[model samples]
Target: MKVLALKFENYRNLDDAIITPCDGVNVIYGDNAQGKTNLLEAFWMFCGGHSFRGSKDNELIGFGKPFAKLEVRFFGQDREQTASIKFKGNKKQVEINSVAKNSAAALIEKYCAVVFSPEHLNLIKRGPSERRKFIDSAICREKLKNAVVLSKYNRTLNQRNSLLKDIYRHPELEETLSIWDNSLLLNGAILIKQRMEYLQMLEKRAAEYHFGISGGKEQLEIRYLSTTNAEYGDSIEQIHQKLYETFEQSRADDIRNGCTTKGAHRDDAEILINGKNARLYASQGQQRSAVLSLKLAEAAVLSERMGEKPIILLDDVMSELDSKRQDFLLNKLDDCQVFITCCEQSNKEQLKHGKIFNVCNGVIS
Candidate 1:
């Protein structure tokens, strides 16, 4: 996939900006807070209908503006695709090729992109939620059905928790807890299986890629630890039974804690290198390689699934790495379309061609 053109209106600091990026590697050079990252965010929003900065739809608008719009044109699967986003108040709408898309998720494959930023290092040092989100997003790209299962599981969990917290205040609601538990088991089991499938794929690819990225001295392993113990299988009956048993085992503690427990929400991924835990033992460089390997592995899988290379957005991250690491990073993008952001003052000599744009104070000049 390649983004041909992008335009933004009333988005954050960018009042009105338009860009035509080259197909290979386009570098956006500017100082900090000059909207270099915002350009990437605008492209990302049009591609996936999500922002890397985690800002809400309303927050995307400029300070005094009431609305924001991101218009993008790109090519995917050998055909041109265009999308537009218009946001006002708390409402947001998306259009694809001039036709309105009903759900943003429906536009996933059409606007597929994978982003890697400096903040991603937290995947190792941070909590389980971040790691789980990594797994969930990749799985979402692979299987849309997992979204349905995840939604139902989350809804059931919220209802179950609210019931637990309020049951004493209205004892009559206690009986409905069983209904929520059943729903959690059904959906949670599906979520667990999808997570295992994805983790196994990541582990297999990360091992080889990590060695290449790390010069073969370090080994990377991704271990998917389930909230409840159960191996991968096709039997929904067995999964449901195992989850039900887990819920029963945790029931007393959950009642006391006032939160639903024993589900994918509590799951985590452990990284090991050379028979030692990466989180506790890997050096800074090793942790960096682990994160990069996981991302590159995602690209490889997406390429295989779509039978075409996916667009990669590398956001001003190279400035943080040394020369050797930078070369390996460039090699990974050699076969794919990559949008790179860099500061002109930093070894801009090392970054190669596709298109070059200047961003200053939110204006692309």
Candidate 2:
């Protein structure tokens, strides 16, 4: 998939502008806080709903502006397509090919892209939630229904937690807890099954990429460590049974803690480098490379599943990498459309084939 053109209005600090990017590498370079990353964020808006930077819908609008509008024309599914997003107040609307859609997630089926920001290195340097997010987001791209499943799971988990707090206070409301438990069991089991399936594919691909990145000197491994103690290859029914028994055993502890303790939300994936925890043992460079491997593997998996390469967005990540890794990103990834953001103009000379756009104070020229 490739972005043909992009138009923005009252979006973040960007001036109203339209960008026509090259089919290959497109570099957005400027000084810090000049809207280079905002340009990439505009491209990413087409991929899913919310900002990869975790900005709220209202936050996407420029100060003193009443609304924000983003539109893009892209080549996908054997033809050129157009999509747009409009944000007003706290509400946003989405449209594809001029057909109105209920939400921004509808764009996932229309456009697919993987992003790597500097914060993504936290996948290896931080705790398990980061890794869980990486897995879950990839799964959602591959299957849109998984997004609904994930949303429902979180909703049910919240309701159950609220009920847990009530049970602590009233003691008589404890009977109603089983209602949420059944919903949580079913949804959490399905989620655990889907996560394991995606992780199995990701683990192999990520390990292969990591090996190439490490010059075949180090080994990388990823395994799902379940909060419900569900084993790999367990059927949904088996998972549900295990979780049900666990919930029954943990009800007292959960009420005392005022939270749902044993479910998919509490699960984590263990990432290992050479049989050691990546979060604890991997060096800074190693962690970046590991995260890079996961991201590239995500792109590759999307390509295999979607039958087309997904666009890659690299936001201010090149400076953290060494020359070898930089070469791999700049010269090796020739098959996919890439939008890279950098603060240094010298980085432009490193590209073999691409167009460069300069941004200064929210203006792209």
Candidate 3:
């Protein structure tokens, strides 16, 4: 799938702009705070339901504007399609080819994309929550069912935690904890299984790519950690039994802790290079290399699953890379349409082939 064009009005600093991206390497470059990231953010919103900047939907609207309008034309599955999303005060809507969509999930799968930025390096360097989110977001994009499993797991976990809080004040709530525990086990186990499978695929892909980037000198490894070490611990049945036992074992502790402690909510994925923890040990260049490899791996994974490669959005990530890495990425981008925001002077030679959009004061010429 490819984004044919992106139309915007009242989005960030972009007042009214329409951009036609190139088939491979469309770079948008400018000085800091010049809306270079905003163009990439627009595409980020296209794939991620929320803004990559963590801004609220309404925040997408230009300051003082009542609403923001975004239209994306995508070529998908041998046909041209359009998706339009609008945001206002506490209101959001999505339309596909002028037909209203029922749920945001329905629209997300229509087009697939993956993004990488400086902030994304945090996935490896940050806490368990970030790592968990990394796996969850990537899995959620590939399979909508993963979202359902995650939602159910979170709801059950929340309810169970509340039950534990109640049990602390009233010992009579002991039995109720079991019911929530069982439910948590059932759903959490499903989530764990899904995540394990997803990570397994991602690890296989990331490892190969990382090896290539490292000139086969270092091996990349990803480890999935769960609550139990039992074989098939990721399986629902095994977890149900294990969770039942764990709850029985932690009956007194749960009452004291006032929260459910065992489940996928606490899961994490660890990245290792040459058997060393990448997050803590990797240098700046190594971190970038790891992230770059992971992103390319993601693209391969998506292509394998979707039977077609999703659109690639490079943003300004390439400019930060060394010439070799930049050239490597530029060469690998042959079959994919890449959209970039860059300054003309960065490399009139490298970007000579892309659709050059001169962005100035919220206008793209």
How many clashes (backbone N, Cα, C below 3 Å) per candidate? 0, 0, 11
Model 3: lDDT to the true structure: 0.75
Off by over 4 Å in 3: 102-104, 230-235, 341-353
Q: Against the hidden reference, what TM-scores do the models get? A: 0.87, 0.88, 0.89
Report the C-alpha lDDT of model 3 over 1-365, residue by residue, as the tens digit: 88888999899898587788877777676666778778888886767457766787777889999999889998987899988888887577888888987655566767777777777888787888988888787777777687888888788888888888988889897876667776677777777777777778888888887776666677888888766553333466876677677667877876799886656777677888889999888777677778877877788788888877877666556545555556555555677877655554644346545666666677667
Q: Please state the error at residue 282 of candidate 3 in Å.
A: 0.5
Best by TM-score: 3
Expressed as tens digits, the lDDT of each residue in 313-347 for candidate 2 is 98986775666666667666788898888876558
**lDDT of each model, Cα atoms only?**
0.79, 0.87, 0.75
Of the pair 2 and 3, which is ahead by TM-score? 3
Which candidate, 1 or 3, has the higher TM-score? 3
Off by over 4 Å in 2: 61-68, 88-93, 100-102, 169-176
Backbone clashes in candidate 1 total 0
Ranking by lDDT: 2, 1, 3
